[model samples]
Target chain A: MDFSSKLLENAVYEMSQLPGIGKRTALRLVLHLLKQPEDQTSRLALALENLRKEIKFCENCHNISDVALCEICSNPRRDKSMVCVVEDIRDVMAIENTSQYKGLYHVLGGKISPMEGVGPQDLTIASLVKKVKLGEIKELIFALSSTMEGDTTNFYIYKQLEGVPVKTSTIARGIAVGDELEYADEVTLGRSILNRIPFENSLKAN
Target chain B: MDFSSKLLENAVYEMSQLPGIGKRTALRLVLHLLKQPEDQTSRLALALENLRKEIKFCENCHNISDVALCEICSNPRRDKSMVCVVEDIRDVMAIENTSQYKGLYHVLGGKISPMEGVGPQDLTIASLVKKVKLGEIKELIFALSSTMEGDTTNFYIYKQLEGVPVKTSTIARGIAVGDELEYADEVTLGRSILNRIPFENSLKAN
Candidate 1:
């Protein structure tokens, strides 16, 4: 049917703008919302308004917060001595769900993609450096993607802390242990060789 | 880390409520919003709010509309006499996307179910029967499921329209050709047999 209603057309246009949601999906969602009671649907509107008017970025970590500092940065129990640097706050959240690491985090705001017009200057790297210079941190983990830009970021960050007396580490690279050798990609094989353990020494010790 | 603000907690909670979206995913969506330029994120919120606020239900068909009548109901080219009945407005939108159907639609709001405390009174069936009784409509299509509740609804609707002149029809039911025998269930087999083609009748007529 011809879409002549301005409200529906606007609603469809707005829903289409969301990531992974298209015009058709947007229409579906809008229709779904319309099926709900006035109270529930209106409350959703209130939530969206509140999200815009009330939510604020943390001044310290650039993570979402209502206050000046984010929860991760302000938590006293979190390990402040070891910091994990990520491309964005989403990465921080992903790592947090794994429950494997206890270190505090620094959200870079984004990777240094010159093609995308994002540079180190555009990120929170300056704040990161200042935090590192505080003399409390002993290690920095580069939890970035394995893209060329990620490598460039790693080298740039390594140079930034050249004489800072801190150990820098990247997450390991290898084929998944049970994965077939034939299925391994070149990058995985290369990283496996570069990070190969001392197999002979371990065998002799055993 | 402990959530320090209700904004963060609320975003996380709301995000988690969406299907397949967890607390971490909500955090990701919120954090992504945090990194965006203020205006872009503001638009997302505005869009959401507009979606909730501006959208209204078409009184005639219950489809979403910006005004009193939805686009479909207002369209002069659409056949007002043929109403495609569906369970939800989302289904209406889905059918609308095909750009093939020209008939008007009747959203049942929900199917009848005794166990769920949903009866004939809970749905828009009464309004539908009234619409049919107006004597303008020529066909009443039962696009409900082929399951037990769908059958019950069809029977109830058929009973309600007794002595009416409009012809009634339903979406077809039968086994899909080329489906593996091993995978075909008893219900499908029975349907296939019941709806068996009359190859012998065609041959004899020739």
Candidate 2:
């Protein structure tokens, strides 16, 4: 769309470059900033700039962090020998929120998606393999999603750790908790039945 | 939600301040930016800062502009005697895209909405009335939205222009173009019938 000011146009263009934001939405957002105090925009800009320039990643897990080692990786209480592998930091956050597991996480950055030109080399697979080879981790849990890309990345890593004297396992896949059985997808329902655990074990989980 | 890095949290917080953006969406957008090249975030931050710091408003119509006088106002071909009063620059751009009107625009910044603590004094209505009182404009067209706040703002401006030598009018309310009459709302359909123009006049509009 035509804009009256070059400054406004430039701002809208840059905003629309973000994922999921279109031109009209970007214009609306920029106009909103104009209506707010000038300090708001300054703070937003400063925060983004500082995050990009100074943000760090955990040396052990490759998770986003403010220091060399993220809080989860550095915490002594967390089970360092039991590392859960995930696609990104968001998954790490999700598991952390549940408070169900006390293990450390190893962020893969992303899964192996050949369609997007992402391979095993594009992620932190090498570092994880090195950690396992060094005999630091006793067990590795594949907590990636159940998608094709996720399965591919998990298998790739599993192959890398062949005969490394480390136990390997995957997260369970079944109908979500609190979901109606009638509405569950066929594959998930079938898997839930096939992988059904003992009633006492399920009771103990809760 | 918890963030691994303080910088990431601050950026997400500022991003979520934009209208319609929630915490989860803000996190997704921030993470997307992190995955992209560093220059992308820097460009977005710089553009927003420059726009907020260097933006200008037209001295004549109060529309966002890069100069003292907007292009539309400074154009010799535009009819200065006929002004279409609108809520903001977005409306100005929309009307300009129609190419059906060649008159100048008077942007009021926003409508009078007491619910939002917005008053007529907060807008550019006084300058428009002063312009009408100075005999610079012969016709004043109220093109604001049909909401309660829009009508209140229109009536307030009309009252301020009382006893002035200007003719006041408002944009017509009717069913949108290409909309089926069977699906038209009762109020719009009734108003369209009551305010029907001659067939020849309708033909002339096209």
Candidate 3:
């Protein structure tokens, strides 16, 4: 006999397609769900359903929202002149969890990757350029990851706003305490070199 | 600001109820769901909703199924005369996963725990005795855990079938190699002693 149920197979297949979930893990998760009260899994299903049916991308920044614009974009309290550009909605949520930033967000959908055929046109870069053309933006902080593709995308965005008065900045990289010096990759090492900070009493003599 | 949306709070509250999931993990999971494409989360919700609406316990074995009797009970090839009683559906699933057991099953829902107010009368033991009275079943296997409640529950089931003409038996116990003997509790140790097997070749010769 076949080793799995049709519904279980279907459910596992769908779950495996999700980010970070593979076939074996998906099967285990499905079995775990089966062990729980049917309501648990049922509620998960309802959340998924509501997410698709009720949520929409914000018209201005393309961030996920249940209304015309996302909460951040719609709110008057958020800094309209300062936009934090990120690769996806995940980055936005990560920043929100920190509770530090009050700026609006622009989700690029994905970073430019030549090998993956994800060019600048594939992202929301053109829309971002159009937004920047309005000249209301005082700053555009690039909170992208410090990978090769991320650098390439950042450089691409930088080139687009060359003549604009907006001040662009990438997140600073610093040496991590307790990190093995031997295990430190060359790029991080190089970035640490470029962004080195001053000692506490070094400027006293000067 | 409180720094948490009402939707985010609701999602976290629901996720916190899951076993092994804590507040921070629940928050992470909720944020991950919120970051996905709206359709993805919606499909997840639909699957959960269908889980409850589509599933029902099998009337015979109490195994979760889409119908009255599970596939095992309704199958003609399985041995109907041999019944294996278990503590829960998870035990039934464990045995079924082995694919070697061809007999029917009786799920007790839980063990007989006086501390927890679970008694034999609350279990499906009466129905099991009724099945035994039909005079067709010849063997009854107890696939219970080796815990105190398991032993007590097994003895209760044994007493309930005083003269039913069925050969009753529990699984064998022995010294599991490389396992910590010091950590082996008294119940397992006593059961192992009760079912000891002669290890020395000289003893067999004698």
Interface RMSD, every prediction, one decimal place:
3.6, 0.6, 4.1
| Model 1 agreement with the true structure over B38-118: per-residue lDDT tens digits | 666556555656666676677888765677887788899998887777776555654565454678888787778898888
Most lDDT-accurate candidate: 2
- Model 3, span A1-206: residue lDDT tens: 12223455566666666555666556556667766677777666655455445556788988766667777898999999999999876688888887778989899988999898899988999999899989999999999988899989999999999898898987677557679878898878887888776765436523
Q: List where candidate 2 sits over 4 angstroms from the true fold.
A: B175-206
Better of 1 and 3 by TM-score: 1
| Tens digit of per-residue lDDT, candidate 2, span B1-206 | 88989999999999999999999999999999999999999999999999999999999999999999999999999999989888888878766765667789999989899999999899998899888899989888777766678768978988897788887766555756544333445455445434544322433454
Top-scoring candidate (TM-score): 2
Give the lDDT ranking, best first: 2, 3, 1
Specify the CAPRI tier of model 1: acceptable
Superposed by TM-score, candidate 3 places the C-alpha of residue A79 at a distance from the truth, in angstroms, of 3.6
Off by over 4 Å in 1: A1-4, A56-60, A75-79, A97-100, A176-183, A198-206, B1-5, B40-54, B69-79, B90-102, B113-117, B145-151, B171-206
The per-candidate count of clashes, in order, stands at 0, 0, 13
Question: lDDT (0-100) at residue A126 of candidate 2?
Answer: 98
Q: Is the docking of candidate 2 incorrect, acceptable, medium or high quality?
A: medium
